[model samples]
Target: MTKFSDFANTLQASDIAELLALTEKPEVISFAGGLPAPELFPIEEMKQVDQAIYEKEGRQAVQYGTTEGDVPLREEIAKRMKKSFFVDCEPKDIVVTTGSQQALFILSQILVNKDETIAMESPSYMGAIMAFDPVRPKYIEVPTDDKGIVPEELDAILAKDDSVRMIYVIPEFQNPTGITWPVERRKAFMDVINKYDVVVVEDDPYGEIRYDIEKLPSLKSMDTQGKVVFLGSFSKIFMPGLRLGWTIANPEIIDKFVKFKQAVDLGTSTFGQRQAAYYCQMFDMDAHIKEINALYAKRRDLMCESMKKYFPKECTFTYPQGGLFTWVTLPKELDAKELMPKCLEKDVAYVPGGIFYPNGGNGNHFRLNYSNMPEDRIVEGIKRLGEVLTEALAK
Candidate 1:
């Protein structure tokens, strides 16, 4: 007899990885993976952090530590958030996690059950939904536009009943959509959610990567009331391998998360947190980030221009300001999955839009990442993607 329960049989593989494995094509270029620009990682600076930490705090560097996270690093994160995100947070309000993804998962575990309702945007990040789905909560999809989620719709969802416990929102350079909510819209959302008892999760992994326009204040900053749980990641701006991300919230929420963090993994890597602290204190993170923004801006420009020049006139795409992705809406009749086969044959890869939706409904949209490809490669990739797109819509 099988040892596992019936629940184990219902589990499904992550949709993102499933498609990747299914494609199995040799020359793979994944717009699907939310990878940061690896070229911009500060190799020399990281090496220096490792060397200095080992020289001074050698034994502690290798051994286990507190679950709340490295005190100095938590302090540094507090400083950075206060200055950059405009959220008036102290070290005690934060819980450092292995990654922001873990923080989100933990939040779902703590908040949701088979009965509680969680409000999410219609086409939110696939990873967030997958994390929530296994827990089997009643999910309600909030409507969205080019400016991100519609505020009135969110108001209705949150006002419904106590069953709606929390909401997951990606306010800036959101994954898949490549849309950033305006400051005014954010203000409206803050006003609405504050009135209701529902909690809002503001996931901002891509907040710092803005390029074309002036940076806007994050929703966390606008939260005059303690209703928003602000999550930040070092993966995009610093390095993905570090897997460092944190949640800043009121003490009640944070204390619970910290206790849970102790149970989950007993804190993130010690060397990782120490090195991150060292990197922030010594090196110029702003200078490094500026270099990243400039380079990604160039890539976004190249991709947009390439699509305009080479793609079929019917194909449309979003002009993202700061993040890596550029959301594209293919011709109405074209199926993104069907086109992927041809796209892969041409050595270009992109995610079909269907996967981003909570319902797994069919969609004509897809997401592309320009930061990984150089200008020349971007041009060639778009040209190749264009050829497949043209063929798909030709009939």
Candidate 2:
């Protein structure tokens, strides 16, 4: 028999991973993944971007680079932070990460020790929970509403628990819930955070995918005390396969993060970094994002409309202003996991919402992703899922 470390011992196969595998059959219309539309990938433009990298930099383009990542990519990211996120940061404040996923892992490792608490929204991103679990930290789910995390509740929790070392949030187009924090909530949340000594990890991967609403300033923009660490990703707006992301933080955290990342993978891909940087310099990234927004917006509207038409009146779901997913809540008696088999029988699928709650027990909800499917398929899938929910409710 083989022995593993304590951390390794605690690990188990993810239920979501297993569920996703089942949804992979070609006949099933899977709304399980937070996948980008592959049809929109800039494959033709990337060929030119790749040729430019090799022609311009030669061997240096593929060689080992500094742990802080490509300077040009960091510089480009800095401009984006100021322009899109309303956070005025320079290149020196940024460090290119492998992906925002890696940033989550590293931040948890560097910031928290075993048994310390990490505060998160009541139903938060599961991937963040997976990243933080390795540290063996206790989790405290703050009260969350449609507006986002409740400031007074968070203030009370932080005041009572000095062990809370970190707070993780997704203020824009959140993963499972697809909720965006209003400006008032952002200010109130920041005010509570300022009073506490904890570090805030603001993950904003889908901030640029908005449809109906005006852009709101990020929590990092309201961060007066250097307490917020902003995480950005190229996966949603650009190709996810490139595996590129960046982090902006206080100088101290960035220094520790770079040193820690040096031990993890030496640095993010030198060639991949140049690919993104060269593409940005040569092409209109904003225009490309506009195309993505248009397609996803259409899909979002279609999915919500279909749900309204097909779903039982007892069920409710969010009509997200933007983002890949909209959360659905079933009647209290019905469990989403229990209904998965029926959905699969109908050649439809969705992720059960319980897994999104780190501490568990919200089995009455599920999440649907509309960005990856076509219009006809989106309508058909929702109709099938509605039938399943209707049957469950009738029973």
Candidate 3:
């Protein structure tokens, strides 16, 4: 028999991963993965961009680059940080990561030791939990509501637990929940954070995919003490296959992060970095994002409308102002995980909500993603899901 490290021994296929595999069949209308619309990918523009890189930079385009990442891409990201996120940062403050996924793992490794507590919103992003799991840190789920993480609950948690070293949050278009913190809540949350000495990992992958709400100031923008580490991704706005993301932090954190990342993959793809940089220089990115926003908004509306029309009266869900997902809560007696197999029988699927809660037991909720499905599929899938829910409730 083979032996493994304790952390390696603890690894098992995630419930989400298993569920996603089931949904991979051609007939299944899956709302499981947080997938962006592939139809919108700039394939033709990328061909031109690739040709330009090879023609202009030759071997340099594909050569081993600095661990800090491509300078021009970092500069462009700095400009985007100022223009879109309201955070004024320079290229020096940024470190290009493999993806925000890698950043999560490295931050957890560097910032926390075993048994130290990491605070997160109740029923937070499961992927973050997976990333942090390798460190074997204790997790404290701060109470969260429609507006986002409750400040009073977080303040009390922080005041009582000095072991809590880091707090992870997705302020805008939060995964699974689709909740955006209001400016007042953001300020109040920051005030509480200012009183504590913990680092805040502000993951904002879906902030740019807005539909109705005005742009809100990021927690990083309000970070006066350099306590916030902002993570940005090109996946939602650009291409996920490129596997590119960036991190902005205090110089000390950036230094440690770059050194650790050097050990991880040497650096993010050199040619991939140039692809994003050249594409930004040559094309209208804002216009492309606007196009994504329009399509997703239509899908969101159709899904919500279908849910309203077909779902049982006891079911409730969020109509997100912007972002890819709508969070649904079933009546307390019904478990989403239990209902999922029935939905699969109907050739439709959604992510079970129980896995989102680190400490477990919010089994009545499920998350639905609208960005990857067509309008007809969204309507048809919801109708099937509603039937499953209605049948489950009847029992």
Q: Write the per-residue lDDT of candidate 1 for residues 1-395, one digit (tens) a residue.
A: 77875667787675456667754554666566677778888998888888999999979897997887888999999998988888887878888889988988889887778878888877888888877876788878889998888989888767666789889999898888888999888888888888888788999999889997777898889887788999998998899998999999888888888888888898799889998899998898989999999999988998899999999999899999888898899777988877776777776788888888877675798889888866777788888888888877777
Per-model TM-score, in order, reads 0.96, 0.99, 0.99
- lDDT string for model 3 (1-395, tens) is 99899989888886666766889999999988899999999999999999999999999888999999999999999999999999999999999989899999999999999999999997799999989999999999999989999999999999899999999999998998998999999999999999989999999999999999999999999999999999999999999999999999999999899899999999999999999999999999999999999999999999999999999999999999888899999989998988877888899999999888878899999999999999999999999998888888888
On a 0 to 1 TM-score scale, where does candidate 2 land against the true structure? Answer: 0.99
Error of 3 at 310 (Å): 0.6
Alpha-carbon deviation at 66 in model 1, angstroms: 1.4
Question: Could you tell me the lDDT of residue 166 within candidate 2?
Answer: 97
lDDT of 3 at 14: 69
* Pairs that collide, model 3: none
Q: How many residue pairs clash in each candidate?
A: 0, 0, 0
Task: TM-score winner between 1 and 3, please give it.
Answer: 3
CA deviation > 4 Å runs, candidate 1:
14-18, 22-26
* Tens-digit lDDT track of model 2 for 198-257: 999999999999999988999999999999999999999999998999999999999999
- lDDT for each candidate structure: 0.85, 0.93, 0.94
Identify the runs in model 3 with alpha carbons over 4 angstroms from their true place: 14-16
